[model samples]
Every structure is written in structure tokens, then in C-alpha cells.
Target: MTGEPILEVRGLCVDYGLGEQAVRAVTDATLTLHRGEVLGLAGESGSGKSTLAYALTRLLRAPGVITGGEVRFHGRDGSLDLLDADAAALRRVRWSRISVVFQSAMHALNPVARIDAQLTDALRAHRPELSAAQRTERAAELLRMVGISADRLRSHPHELSGGMRQRVMIAMALALDPEIVIMDEPTTALDVVTQREILTELMRLKDELGFAVVFITHDLSLLVELADTIAIMYAGRLVERGPARALFERPLHPYTAGLLDSFPPLHGARVRMEGIPGSPPALTALPPGCAFHPRCPSARERCRVDQPPTAAPAPAPAAATAAPAAADGERTAACWLIDADRETPARPARTPGSTP
Candidate 1:
């Protein structure tokens, strides 16, 4: 509401079926992306993080439908309502205003085409006024932006290493000067060294381009280091969303605490990670009230009967809550243990927005 938000999502719901048996893949989700901010969407598999990403671009297909929501993309000339846009309108906006760098770069790039050709296609599609020479010049610059040599543009997808191919994917996404980039597990296929290198390069690129990023990954630790804000999802609903620092310091949600507990701290040696107990409930028959209630260690009778209202999870009392938050302020969380009416003692202090 303050700065010029580049993207706004409101009451977004994506359902997979019709009538009483309909399953909600994403439920009443809402968020905003400000210019140049990197917002991490973190959760375990089946939490609907990817669904939300695809929905933002109106990319959901078949039985998977955008049952309700408004995705408003703020553009230079005026605000564009993505949910209301026709096929042609959506096509024009897809790569030009918003782009995607998915998990598998090899599949994203055409194995038969040289990298230069793909990059050129993106340029010509978005900037038709540019001549072939001009587009080639721009393509070379993009390759350089992602730390690849311009000469690699002549190479085909099969000829490049996984990291190089991923970099090419990044370069392609950047070619159109999109206002936002959605990366779904961008570093998943590479080795540790390559992952770090790519992430470092991505951070640098983000700094240089000043484009908002929606980075989706289950790796919470990486997100903690790179994201400006974090949103934790559970069973297709955003259980918590707040400033990264605030969320990490005084995480208000039980689900978030479980995620934090599962990751080893950067300074510490590798410790045994205790994953959240039980798998996510089936979407077709999601639990009554809060979907997380079935697996939540802190779940109460009320939690089973009524969904917890989203609220700030305050630090425990000065003496009882262990050490006070390293930082001030709590964050928004969705858990019944934080309910003001609940009798459970104050939970331990954990960063609200800390990542995987």
C-alpha cells in the first residue's frame, strides 16, 4: 500500500474440480510484490507454492482452475489485470512483464536450437522494432549478465553443462527486462558448488537489474540469506508472511518453527534434522478447520474444531520464554497455539521469517 507495488494478488483460489468434491489447491492467498524485492515462497512439497506461482501468471491448465482471485500487475502505462486479460493480452505480458526460470533448464531450452536463437526469439517477440544485429548485441549482453561468455550463445542446450544451461535460462528470462521473475527451484539440479555459484550470481543480477523476484524453493537456509521477505505456506494456504528479519526473530507460527528446526544454522556443524511429523493431508479430503491441525504438535481441541485466526505470535514472558528475541517485534502466523484464548504457554522464540 505504500510504495508502488509491481504485483498484487488478492483472495486467490485455485480449485481442481467442480461441485461439492472440488479441491482447493490454493486457498484465499494474497500478497504483494514491490519493485526489486526478493520474496521467497517456502514450504514442503504439496504445500501449493508452485500452484501459487503458476496462478500468478494465469498458467494453470485443465481441471486445475483459477476459481477466484485477482492478479493485478502494475505496468508503466497503467495497471494490467492479469486475471481479466484475454489470451493475446496474456501472451504479450507473459515474458515481457513477468518471466519464469524453472527447475530444469534443459527442458526449458530447445535442445535443437542454439542458445543465441532462443535468446533472439525472446528479444524479437518482445521488442519487434529492434533489428537482428541490435537483438544479437542485446543477447550477448544478457549472456554476460549471467556470467556466461557471449560465445556460449552459439552452443546448443545439449552442449552446455547444467549450470551453464541454468544460467542461460536466467539470461533468457532477463532478456525482456521483465518487472518480475518467478524462479521455481532454480538451483535444484546442480551440485553444491554450482548451486552456490548460481545463487551468488543471481543475487548480483538482482542487485543490478532491480527487478522483483518470487524465488520458490524448499531450501529454507538459502532463502534466509537472500530474501527480503518470506511467506510460509501449508496445505495451500499462507500460514505466515512477514518481513524476513521479523519472522526469523520471533516466528509466530508453529508451522514456521518446524521448518526452522529442520534446517542447520550456518555457523553450526551439520545436525540431525527432525522433519515435521506426518505428510501433508490429501488435498481432495483436506482436514476440517486448519489442515495443519492434524500434524501440529501444539494442536488443541479448538484447533480441530475452528481454524486459528491469523495473528502475531508474541515472545514468551521475559523469564519463561527462554532468551528474548535477538530482535524486536513478532510476525503474523496461522496456528491455534498463538490464539489469545488458548491456554497453552507461550511458545519458544524463533525467527518469524527464517527460511528453509
Candidate 2:
């Protein structure tokens, strides 16, 4: 069930200032998106999930810059490195080949524009060959795809509910049927039921349309349910990534484990929720060795002086169960605590008031 590689990222770094004072918001972040696959990125508020998405799509403004990286989009037209592409080059690749449903999607919609206009505008711009009738017809189809009625096409943003507004944004993103869709917290403000509905609708559309999705959110639990693969980011770096189930069942990184623990169980029994202790370090003055050492419960002396690269697949011991084999992308993490053969200490229970 592996889809073809639609997007590949390597050493993606993004900074927010000039040299000597630059704060690296996305450091050496790497991952892949296969066609029709859902890749979920989960992390803290500032772990750079949105930044990575913006950088990949070349949406970052002046203060944010892509310091280094390669973002290649493989298409029938052939592969193109988005990072190296000029404005015109990127313009051609974006939207038509890839589209983004930004965070707070409702806010992204034009307040004054009608739903039909907002959704069909991209089509008018990208597919000028289509006449007004064709654009309007296509817009209605897009709306229907997201479970919205064509009758609401003339409605304004203020008339729609939060969920419907988000749906309009999704429909607009699919206006051109792009190969890849990067969704940044598309369901952040919705209620649990709405979130589930929106996610379910998105998955159905993805299946019907055959588009790869890179869904970014802080909720690991949500990702586990929707994403085929999950990548955990930390302190501006991708600390761990693996199959969604694998990462959930036996997370390799302490941060990943803490993130999972932080989630309140939806069913079974109610328990006290303990989030990861200590705030993430400022990128300008990150810890010398591993950025996570200060907060990692299983961190050792080795983790204090030397940084660990995202490791290759580790051999599983006979008695211990290993993390599931990755479907396609890299299955690695930057934690020293996890080794398939070596006995790593179990993560310590959470402690309140723990600080850096």
C-alpha cells in the first residue's frame, strides 16, 4: 500500500534572522510524502510544523528564510526542486501542482468574496482556458466534494459556520486538483465532532481525488487516526518519525513519548494528564548537545555532550518488540535512548514543575 514519492525533503532549514543572530526555526527537517498518503506532523506550538510547511511551499516572508534544504516535487512533468526555483518557477509549481490549506482556514478565506468567487478565482487564474460557466460548474463540484451544497455558492464567509468555512478552503485548495496538499492545522478551532467530520471528509476526498496530504497539528492522537505516517518535531528539528501505529505503540524519542502521554484518553478510564515538563529551548541559545536533554526523562550523560543523528533502523532484540517497519519514508529519530539491541532506560514518569 505504498504510494509513489510525490514530495521529498532533505536538510530543510529555516531561520528567522540574519547570521549571528538567526534563530533556526526548522533545523535539518526531512521527510517524504507519497501520492495519496497522509503524513502527519505533530509537535509543540513552536516546534516549526507551520514553518516547515511555509518554507516548503515558499510562503515565508522576509524575516523567515530557508537557510538550506532541497524540496523536490516529483510529477509527470518531471522533478523540480522547489527551494531552488525562482518566483516564476515556484509560481508555476505551486497551486497547480501543490496547494496549501493554511491554518485558521476560515481566516484565510476572503471576507468580502462570495463562496463561488473565492473558490473559482483560482480556477480562473490557473485554468483561464475554462469559461465562466465551466469555472462555476467546477466550483460547485468542489463544494459538493467537501459535503457542501451548490446552493450556498453565493453565500459569504460570515454566513458559513466554522466547519463550512474550513470546507470551502479545502474545496478551493482542490480547485485545480493538485498532486499534493499541505494542511496546517485545518481543524484547530472546531469541536471534536466537527474535527472528526472535517477529517473524515478530507480523507474521503483524498481517496476519491488521489492527492497526498501533509497534515500539521499538535495533536498526536488526531494524527494517529488520520495519518499513514507520523513525524514528531522538537526544538525545531525532526526528532522522530515512523509509521503512525509504530510511533504510537513504542515511541523511540522521549519527546514523542511525552507527547503521547500528554493526550487525555478518549475512552476506557479517565486519568490525570501530564504534559512534557519544561518549555522548549530558544533556538538562538539551544542546549549544546541534544536540545532535548534538559527535559528528556531518559536522557543520559552521552546525551549531554553529543548530539544524535536520526538513526537508521536498529536491530530488534529477540524478546523485545521493535517498532513497526516504516511504510516508505525514513524511520529514524535523534534520541540516544532508543536502540533495538541495547537496553535503554525506560522514560521516567512525569513530574510537575520540572523546568530547564
Best by lDDT: 2
Q: In model 1, which runs have C-alpha deviations exceeding 4 angstroms?
A: 1-3, 266-272, 312-330, 339-356
lDDT of each: 0.81, 0.84
Summarize candidate 1's per-residue lDDT along 1-356 as a digit string, tens digits. 11469998998999887889778899889888888889999999999999899999988776788988899999765799999999998998889889999768868889899998999997897789999999999999999988899988889999999999999999989988888999999998689899989999998988887788999998776787778888999989999887776556545677786777776554434556666788888888788888888877778787788886666766556664333554334356777666344343233333433233
Best by TM-score: 2
Write candidate 2's Cα lDDT for 216-242 as tens digits.
999887887788889998889999888
Question: Clash totals for all models, in order?
Answer: 11, 0
Shift in Å, residue 82, candidate 2:
0.8
Poorest lDDT segment (10 consecutive residues) of candidate 1: 345-354
Model 1's number of clashes is 11
